[model samples]
Target: MAYLADTYIRFPIKVRNASGVRIWDLDGKEYIDTFMGIGVLLFGHNHPNVIRAMKEKMERYVHLSNFFLDEDAEYVARRLISETGKGGKVFFTNSGAESIECALKVIEKFRKRNRRKGKIVSFVKNFHGRTLGALRITGFERIRIPFIEHDTEVVFLPYNASEVEVFMKAETVDAVFLEVIHGSGGLNMIPGEVVEVIKFYQKKHNFLLVADEVQSGLGRTGKFYGYQHFDLDPDIVTIAKGIGGGLPLGACLMLGELADIFETGEHGSTFAPNPVALAAGRVILQMITAELLEHVTNIGKAFKEIFSQFGTVRGLGLMRGVELEKRVTKEEFLSEGLLVNIVGEKTIRFLLPLNVSNDELDEIAERFSRVLKV
Candidate 1:
């Protein structure tokens, strides 16, 4: 009966409106949104500042091609680079997948230019994106590999810190992909020492370290960048999800010599760096102050303490994954008016908005307790 593709696992609830951490369905039922639009709504739905930015930009212009120099986009890019404390270049895109696509081209091209092999190393159970190029680097083979193929040679390695030293020393890798906090893949963490080891070898072997911050960036990890938690500094970082404040936007941050590899007209996007989206993104980035990050860290600790009563909780900042002895199903949360994703066999992921109130989180936890009891 429907004309559109049935790509998503369709839910029956039709949301009429949402504000903050609450979503109201057509039937007038209220739900506490713990998933936070899959970690896209960093400040929650219809945030005042985000809306203000969009309104101001919309009054001027909404769309702008890559040909023109958009001021808002430039403003946001400056902040992004400054946050990293590294003077680098950035390429804007409409989504995380597109950013990865750009990174793939830039890194691969850099390797080829240097007379290096076209080999990429990423961790097992780590997710990058669903596009053809990103899928090749993604460790989950069962989802998209059958429909697509890649020419780039990719090797999936374990997330062990000790083994990374062995593997990196042995392989002739061109680029190494990392997601410091695994977002979609059960919320696994890249150990602190693993990053140290990679940093140690990256200098010795002379390889590019691409941090996939699509889901874990933008204060979601209690830091401006998820890679900041570790001692390692990535050469290329792809960011999205929360940057646009619910509108589609993403960027690839390049540092050191890797910054100027993408020549003019080499790689670009048609819908990237839109004036409206850029305005929203700029405001969101400004809103993420050190105080807010510290607040997120505190909230994560409080939530973890409460979550431990139910099961094992692991992850950084607000992007924690609770692994229950008796896993909490998505259906269970739905019935109890809570929105969360059952990431795996016994894992429920929590992607709370950065500015979510402690009261809201307490209520969600209370609801979670009741759901588990039943």
Candidate 2:
């Protein structure tokens, strides 16, 4: 018996060890891991290259404050900035929520500098994060109520292009934060036309366009970033989950003139740029090149074909959700030894790693078919 928080009473799976698309429970029962640490293990549990890099860095150092710049930190940041293709700068943090905080702070600072109390327009059912400021901007109210008093001046809008002009014309609208493909908010895919409208509004109003790619970045969505699904360039993009393999690391990439909004002391974290985590992030990114990305995409297509037999598959690349029938619940599948998660009551979210093999994908699909039959 484990002494755990009541929060976990709803879904209890005591893991003893995990590696490569599979995890073993405390009772030695091995199961395929479709959740992938909530989309953190892009290369799967204990990837060799990531492990080697982290071990090497551990031998050198572990926790160094942001006061001194580490080589790995600089390396990862440079690579990320170069890939963003927007002349952007990067600020690292320890978690996705912190990265959201950094992004919000940058937008707010930009507003303050421009002497505009602009409002931030967010889409309905978009999940940014759960921190105070991030929670304020998040479209979900169940998580926002605790900090309602401290919420920012954010306006909720439908995830469609037709409503863009009206919202942008509203007074004091400063930035637009969105997830090209909503992940936690039910794997909802934003229409390409909606993205085009956002670009138009950003050009017309001069307000910042922010893409919250925390759950959709680092090749999770068949592209380097989810925004790539649409022909658009955001002023700022936040990322986390798969960046550091399995380690905790988050980054906020700022583009155009918005990159200079944060001064030296405007934002930071004690473990933000830990060399070990940065090394892991760099190696994981290298492992997810064109070939691996294609592999993931192909496997995703296969999985979708199998999952389509059950219900609609909603999402791109490995960040997909199988919307099951009302009679089929996510918890039912999990209890049957498949490590899938619920996006909602009727949807089983599958965040496959970029390096997952085709054979493993087939096995998972077969198991899922069996479970769904039950």
Q: 97-161 in candidate 2: lDDT tens per residue?
A: 88888888888788778898878888888888887778878888777776675445788888767
- Candidate 1 lDDT by residue in tens digits, 1-374: 29888778855689999999999999899998888889999999999999998999999888868779988878899988888888799999889999999898987788779988746898888888888888878878786568565545788888888788887777787889999878778888987778788888788888899999898888998998888888668888998888988889999998878888878788878889878889999899889999999999999999888888888899988989998887566777889899877776888889999987788888998899899982
TM-score of each: 0.96, 0.94
Q: What's the CA RMSD for each of the models?
A: 1.5, 1.9
Best by TM-score: 1
Segments in model 2 whose C-alpha atoms lie over 4 Å from true places: 1-5, 149-152
lDDT of 1 at 272: 90
